[model samples]
Target: MTPIQALYYFVEARPTRTGPPNVGIGAILLIVAAAVFIAWVAWLWIAARPSSGGEETALNLQPYLSDDELETTKLNRVLRAAM
Candidate 1:
């Protein structure tokens, strides 16, 4: 047989000296980097986005709760305190 054939046979027949390399950390790091990059791009895209034709300031969200809701909250707080 040719030298190349002998080498191939030896390599194929011999057992591998080392088991599969540990790539979990590298894969996790790669995923984390990709996520971070994606997040950064999304943040930049949102920041540089053009504003709609409207008021510059955003509306505040503040709706007062009903009396019954307040009373229920108070009762829950009291029960929590008792516990």
Candidate 2:
């Protein structure tokens, strides 16, 4: 046999059937990235939801009424009639 072939056999450096070593690491990194992205989207969705506080004020009916006729009972009646 040639010297090169003999040397190769002595070193026992055979071809590998598996792919590159970094392939598994790359897959794991992609999975982690997907998880992080999903978590961020979910956080944004939750933060955008309306709160259950009583801070939402009703539309001012006083604008449609005159100064002399400005009354809550009158406004409620007018609103009910309009609706």
Candidate 3:
């Protein structure tokens, strides 16, 4: 009816802004993103695992010892006990 309304309608071509001009993004991109995220998380999880090696070294830390360090350790323990 008004000149400004007519001009606006003609310029806009559409009455209201369409949410989207057309459909949407394809599913492939979403799938790729999910795969990449999963792979990244898996790599981080694997890298975080402890890689402690040498069973003999681990056993040396225990109380049972056939080495000379055990005598000094026992003496220290006795001194602490005496104190």
Candidate 4:
């Protein structure tokens, strides 16, 4: 056979087979990075939430009074200002 015919025969003789789709390295890394970012944001959101029962312990009452005292003080101040 001639060289051109042999080349054409060689090209057509290969088997045609379907294969699994390929996933790029960048796509895999992007998925992993997105998952990590979501986890990080979730952690930050959870950490930033107000802690119940912890506010009372963190409050210092030296410069402030109880709610009853504050109301009475406000009333007295208003009365004094009205005079």
Top candidate (lDDT): 4
State the local distance difference test value for candidate 3.
0.82
Q: Which one wins by TM-score: 2 or 4?
A: 4
Regions more than 4 Å wrong, model 2: 1-23, 54-83
Local distance difference test scores for all models: 0.86, 0.84, 0.82, 0.87
Residue-pair clashes per prediction, in order, are 0, 0, 0, 0
Q: For candidate 4, give the lDDT.
A: 0.87
Q: Candidate 3 at 79: error in angstroms?
A: 46
lDDT for each residue of candidate 4 in 1-83, tens digit (9 for 90 to 100): 99999999999999876885588788899999999999999999999998785445446555667789878988799999999
Better of 1 and 4 by lDDT: 4
Per-residue alpha-carbon lDDT of candidate 3 for residues 1-83, written as tens digits (9 for 90 to 100): 89999998898896776586554566667888999999999999999998876546566576776567767888789989999
2 versus 3: better TM-score goes to: 2
lDDT of 2: 0.84
Off by over 4 Å in 1: 1-18, 56-83
Deviating ranges (above 4 Å) for candidate 4: 1-21, 54-83
Predictions ranked by lDDT, top down?
4, 1, 2, 3
Per-candidate TM equals 0.38, 0.39, 0.34, 0.40
Error of 2 at 72 (Å): 30
Worst 10 residues of 3 by lDDT: 17-26
Q: Which 10 residues in a row give candidate 1 its minimum summed lDDT? A: 55-64
